[model samples]
Target: MGLSSPTEIVATDKVEVAFKNLDAAILVGSMPRREGMERKDLLKANMAIFETQGTALEKYAKKAVKVLVVGNPANTNCLIAMKSAPSIPKENFSCLTRLDHNRARSQVAMRCNVPATHVKNVIIWGDHLSKQYPDVHHCKVNVSGGEVACFDAVKDEAWLKGDFITNKSWKIVEGLPIDDFSKAKMEATATELIDERDTAMEFLAKK
Candidate 1:
């Protein structure tokens, strides 16, 4: 028997282990082949890509793999992909909300004069884009290890309805020239990572 025979078996077993341990998958799409796109339009474009990817996963990957859609119009894109692959559970698909959550946490921490860690169980719900509802209603911030309801007194219905929505929702336009060309150029460094790695596949395949 060859000395390397057992090593081959171990390598194969590790592959199986990796496939087994995969809990969920994330799918990202390249830029849609369109201009002047709305959220719905963007979602429509990405859905075509996600649909294919979702089908591939259902056919080739492990059963019961959760899917997270990181592309724009994420929630709708997720829904479209989920529908495309009926074999994969619908609940298994979701959109990324961590960015909004982080932003909210940072804002809250700054407002309340507490470290970000002091914020407990911050829930970011609904559509991942501008339409998302950052419900700080249930969130509690710790000050000196004391828990306090952050949004308890914010009962002004008119202000909450109009002002909050207007302030929270904004258009994030990139590729615009700001005075700080150095910072913008530095930001462009992310393109290399995008070039090298399939971030969508990595997220989906990660344990």
Candidate 2:
């Protein structure tokens, strides 16, 4: 290995060792599912894992550590980890939204027949879960004809407002809206990491 490499990989299977003295904790890997495991069982199983990880972070990691949970049911896992680490500031804990963030942009880009880069101001509102919403009310598409509203370009509420996963039972979930407009836009759209796209799979398959 080059001595000047910016980062080094110190792979380990020990959770205690991994959660300690870190600048940032990204809990992305999930425990492999067992046969006949129900959905709730799976959630509980991961919850236990994150709970332990969170406790360790509190006890040993820097008080300023930032955490991002990206495992399955990331929102719940995010909640479990945040609640577990009381000493750690609440704002420091978050779930991965890049997947969904890019998705909302892609959908807008496709609908407008432009590159994904042309889509802007799209926000993923609500908990980063299946029921999480992709809000485009404020989204803008940079078409040749200057900028156009996403709704005007797509013109299909059915395509834009599609079914997503997870229960919307909690008063709080991923992507909380900051205002009445955002709140309504959040309510209007509905979603999940569950990007099964071949490119996403390829990235996950990499070391």
Top lDDT hit: 2
The parts of candidate 1 lying over 4 Å away from their true place are 1-23, 30-35, 152-207
Candidate 1 vs. true structure, TM-score: 0.60
Off by over 4 Å in 2: 1-5, 31-37, 127-130, 162-207
Query: Each model's number of backbone clashes?
Result: 2, 7
lDDT of 2 by residue, 120-161 (tens): 887666544445777777788888958988878777866676
Clashing pairs in 2: 126-174, 126-175, 127-173, 127-174, 130-165, 130-191, 131-165
Whole-model Cα lDDT of every candidate shown, in order = 0.55, 0.67
lDDT of 1: 0.55
Candidate 1 lDDT by residue in tens digits, 1-207: 112333552223232333333455666653453666653445445655776666666665557777778775455566656766788766677777676777777666776777887776555445443445555555778877678776643334454334543334212345643335324433443343232224333333442
**Model 2: lDDT to the true structure:** 0.67
